[model samples]
Each structure stands twice: as C-alpha cells, then as structure tokens.
Target: MNFLPTDDQLAFRDTAVRFAREKLAGTYLQRARIHTLDRQLVREMGALGLIGPDLPEEFGGMGLDYTTAGLMTEAIAYGDFNISYIQLLASLMGGMVAQHAGRDISMEWIPRVIAGEKIIGLGLTEPRGGSDAAGLQLKAEKTANGWRLNGEKTSMSAADQADAAVIFARTEDSTTGSNGVSAFFVDLTEKGISRTHFDDIGTKPVGRGSVFFDDVVIPSECLMATEGRAFGTIMAGFDFSRALIGLECIAPAQASVDETWAYIQEREAFGAPLAQYQGVTFPLAEAETQLTMMRQLCYYTLNLRDSGNSHTAEAAMCKWYVPKTTCEIIHQCLILHGHYGYTTDLPFHQRYNDVLGLQIGDGTAQIQKLVIAREKVGRVALQYDKQAKGGAA
Candidate 1:
C-alpha cells in the first residue's frame, strides 16, 4: 500500500522529483572526484524555496512544516545526497537560530544561506572527542571585544566553503558534561580561521575538512545560539536530523535498486532473462522488502516528529535500520550487476561508498542505541531534561 503523501505532499514531492531528475543529474563519481559544491544548483534550490521550507517567511523561507521538509529532502537525496546534505543543513541551522537564538540572526543569515551565498557547518566533532561531543576539548574564552575560539574541529562538512560556522568549545566554568560547552559562530574568512579539505570515500562534494580556530575573534553578530545554551541546539538538531538521515540512507539504495532492476530485465542468462532466475528475484524481493520497512519506519518517525513528541527512539530505530538496510541493498544490487556495480562508470561504486557515512554521522548506531537504552529502561534522558519533557537536554 502507498504509505504517505497527502495531496499537497504529493505535489511537493512532484516538484522535488522533477528538480532532482533535471537539475541535480550528474555522475556521482564525477561530483565526488571534483569535490566541488554546485553553487549554481544551490542557488536554484534557494530560488525555488527548497532550502528553508520550514523556516519563517519573514526570514526568507516558505515556513511550511516538518512533513514538507522531509518530502523535499528525500526527493533531492534521490538525485544527489550531497545536495540533500547542504540544503537540509543550511535550512535547519537557520531555523534553529530562529528558534533558540533570535530573529535577527535568522533574518540575516538565513537568506544568505538560502540563496547559496553562504554555507554553515555544525562544529561539534573535535580532534579529541567525537561521540562524547560534550567532552569536547576545543576551548572558547570570553574577551573584551567578543570571544576567542582556539581549537580544532575535525570531520566538519562544508567547512571550506562555509561563510559561517557554529564552533562548539569548552568553557572555563563548564561542568563535567555538555554544560561546559558553548557554541560560537566563526566566520571562515575571518583572521586565524583556517580549513583544509580531507579526501574520503564518499560525499566528496561535501567540502569536508578540518577547521582550526586559532584565537579567531568572533563579533557579537556571529554568535549563534548563546554560549551555555549552544549544546542544547546541537542535541536538538539530532532528534530531527536523525529522521532526515533515514532518508539519506534510502536515496542511494533506491537508486541502486532501480538501476539493477532495469539491468536485470535487459540482461539474459541460461537462454532466458535473469529476471526468471530465483537467484535474481529473491535478492530483489529481499532488498525491496527491507527498504519498504525502512521507508515505513521513517514515515512514522516523521509523523511522530510533527506531533511535537520526542521521536528519538523511533529516529534511532530508523538511523540504525535504514543505513544497514541501504548498505545491504546496495551491495546486493551491486552483486546483481556483476562487475558493472564495481566500476566507476556506473556510479554504484560511489554510492556504495557514500552510504557508509550515514551509519557513522548523526551519532553512530552504537551511540544511538545508548540513547534509546537510556531513555527506555531507566525512563531517563542521557542528559538531564531541563524542560521536563522526558527528552534530551
């Protein structure tokens, strides 16, 4: 049965699908090889109001809803996951600033990001600490002028091109955990702020890099969410963004499936079509069924998310299930393609590499399990729930 898409959602999906197929079409391998963010495509997406569909209209966005955001993100991911990552993050970061920080920052930065004139990265991961993001070692100190950020953030996506960034750093009075962390908005072009790109297996178009903050003095306008309150913003991002990660897992798996399905129908063996072989049919059946489950779970999580409830457990379930399933499906599709899947010519090789990041980013599967386990058995949050919502702090 068809799982989602109200009439309006269907229309939204149609618009996104057309954009994906037409504008975002390119060889995934080529995109990665160049490691260049498609500035033109990003601007076109902004012009189409795809960047911040849920952000406030006054802030230069459509301000739709979670469902619409998910629909659009998934559609674009179906074409290019790198594009999905940029648009999803730019819009979400802007909205977060609106919600937790203020309207002024959103009003100014949101439009620039939406227009693809700027990029932003969440600087949580550090050289010393990763999953223990609260245990971050990067230090930020107060100054007469503003703040001085002195530390390094690793595995930062889009850092090289980012006009601005949210750099999480350790504070002097910080307690043992996330409390000790504060967020700073650092301009990449500002003095003492430097970044170097890192080559990786997938998502090469991501401008992923190491950003060193060498006493980078950020002005007051650059401050994103407040210092002590910054950790809250980062944690809050995951609950929603994890659901988006589920969509990320699906895109390449879906692409591989479609590609393999066509190939199987066209290629023949044993004097008959490979489609007639149970060997071919069973794997396809398994991949489709597994992907169906991932899709359903993601849809449910998105619905729960829209209801103002904590879907962290469900998001965890999806973040765990979808990537594993997507990886398996992609591998199976690759096998079904024989050697073509292994070739850079087909793009499956690149897709196979790209799917690995979803499992690692947005809190690893192991970390996600810890989150759910803490929430479920103890009826508690990993961090203290200040709002009494029984959710993440």
Candidate 2:
C-alpha cells in the first residue's frame, strides 16, 4: 500500500511541524519538568485545528483520515513529546466518544475537546492492573436516573486535569473478566470524585494519576455501547492509538538522532570530528534505518485502520516494538553525546525519559507480543495456559 502523503496531508503535516518547531520546541524542556500542561498552549493547538483533526466535520474536526492523524501526531511529537499526548488522547478518546456516545454527548464534548476548551481522559486501567484491561473491578450499578460508580482508575494520563473521562466499570455482579464491563462518560467535577498525581520520572506534563470514583453518578445516556459488552467495542480504538503512539515515541528519538548528527559534525574527538569516526556514525546510521522502518510500520498500521482492515497484530507490533526500539535508539543517542547527554541542558535525557514511559504505558512489550501471537494463532496460543489452570481449552 502507498504510504505517501497527499497534498492535503502534507499541508497539515507542514502546519503541525511549523507550530511545533516555532512554539513547542523552544519550551519543551521547561514544559517537560512541570506536572500540569499549560492550558493556554493546549488551546492554541486547538485553535490551529491540531488536536483532533480526524474525528469528523460535524464534531469540529476536518474529517481527515487516520493516516493524516498519524502524520499530525508525528510532526507535533517532534517538537514536544509530552504535548503530543493531547493529540493522542483526543483522537483515541474522542473517536471512541464520537462512535459510541450519544450524539448530544458527542456534540457537546467533542467540539470542546477539539477546541482545547476541555480534555477527556481514558479511565480503563484500574489500581489492580493495566495490561489485564478486561479484568475490571470498578462497579457501576444502575440507579433511578443513571449509574453510580465506585472504583479507582490508576496510571491514567491527565487524571487530575481532565474535564471528563470515559470510565469503564463492571456491571454484572456474577460475571468476571470482560463480560460484565460497561463504559461510561463521567464528569470529573461530579461529587465523590477525587484524584491523586504520581511523581513520574517522565511525561510529567501528562500527569499520570489515579481517579477515585466514590459513589459518583452519571446520567443514563453516559453509558456507551452495549451495557455488558462495551469492553470489546471501546477497545477497538486502541489499535488506532497504538500506531499513533509508535509515531509519538519515534519523533523524540528522531529529534535526538538529528541533534546528535549535527553535534558530531562540530565536536572533535581524537583531533577529528566525531562524524569521521565509524564508531559514532555507524550507530546513528543504524538508528536512521530503524527509525525509517518503524515510521513506515506505524503509518502502515494507520493506513490499515483507514482501509477498514484488521490490524490488531500490526498495531500490537507497533505498540511493543516501536517504543522499546525507540527507547534504545534514544539511549544510544544520549550516550553518543557523551556526558552532555546526561545533563539537563540538553534534551537527550528528557527525550529518553519521555519515550521510556511508552514502553510501560498502553501495554508492555510482553503484553503486545502476546497480543500479536494471539492474533496470528487465535485462542490456540492461550489454550495451554487455560489447560494448565484446569479451565476448558
């Protein structure tokens, strides 16, 4: 399949790149250290139609394809990796809402999200686990007017800062795993909702935290998809996000590599420029090759999604491989810069730390590999574990 950007896609990418380079790159380091993102900056991105340009024209988006969305993600990420989280969340969470939530809900929130007037965070991962997404413990009991939620979601980006969230809860008392799970659109300002932030090593601006829902209530219209089957339907959006995430991680590593390449030309070692050394140049060359491949893979996955094709395996591959490899590439770039890379004055350390989070967030390498295997061989790959545990295979 062709991965070349069309004129319109290229135009969007150029605009995103210009905004990133001009506005985001200059303050990336300063912004990275902060716990909360600057809302004004987020609004500026919204004003530029850079947040969720792929949602739909009716929802305040430009009706762009997922591939164009990936392009925008990559371009913005090149300037500020953390800031790109906004674009990622908007597309992932906003798309879910647009496709699943009631029209009124989508009409009200999607525009705000697109306008950067509000933020909607995902509430899938619980305090128990993130990778085992279906094993939810949050409770959502039907009330007279709506549902009452009582549970805690952990490791969510923008937990404390989100205006609202798409929360998942188990509605069936006798069921376990994904069966009883239901999704909800809950306002974070509702009563009994509390949040706590973590002192993460990176992506601090995204503010990974726990959102505790204590007897929180939401209207019946908040329920998304089938009551007991929302888990599977809502999760399909992740395949899209996974590919976008690949681009997100790749951008910073790419930026680091680009900087190191320029650096080697000026820095002298052994009375010669570092660029003249095969030892220094070879790793950068290898990095470029890998980056090119990973970028294509990510865009290919996005294209698969745009084409209405099954991409679970490819998305899993992108999710697992790209983040891990990009982290390594960033680390190597950091080392190639010597001690300066370790210092805060340079962006290498920050880029490493920022990209490092993706290796753990979304899903871990081991988990993604399992997903890939499951996709290739179906449930057969997991039958052995079920048999060992005395369950029906």
Q: Whose TM-score is greatest here?
A: 2
Q: Per-residue alpha-carbon lDDT of model 2 for 6-74, expressed as tens digits?
A: 999999999999999999998899999999999999999999999998998998888899999999999
In order, what is each prediction's RMSD in angstroms? 4.1, 0.8
User: What lDDT would candidate 1 get against the real structure?
Assistant: 0.77
Which candidate ranks first by lDDT, i.e. highest?
A: 2
- Model 1's C-alpha root-mean-square deviation from the true structure amounts to 4.1
lDDT of each: 0.77, 0.93
Residue-level error in angstroms, candidate 1, position 26: 4.0
What TM-score would every model get versus the actual structure? 0.92, 0.99
Question: Which residue runs of candidate 2 sit more than 4 Å off their true CA positions?
Answer: none
Number of backbone collisions per candidate: 1, 0
Ten contiguous residues minimizing lDDT sum, candidate 1 = 378-387
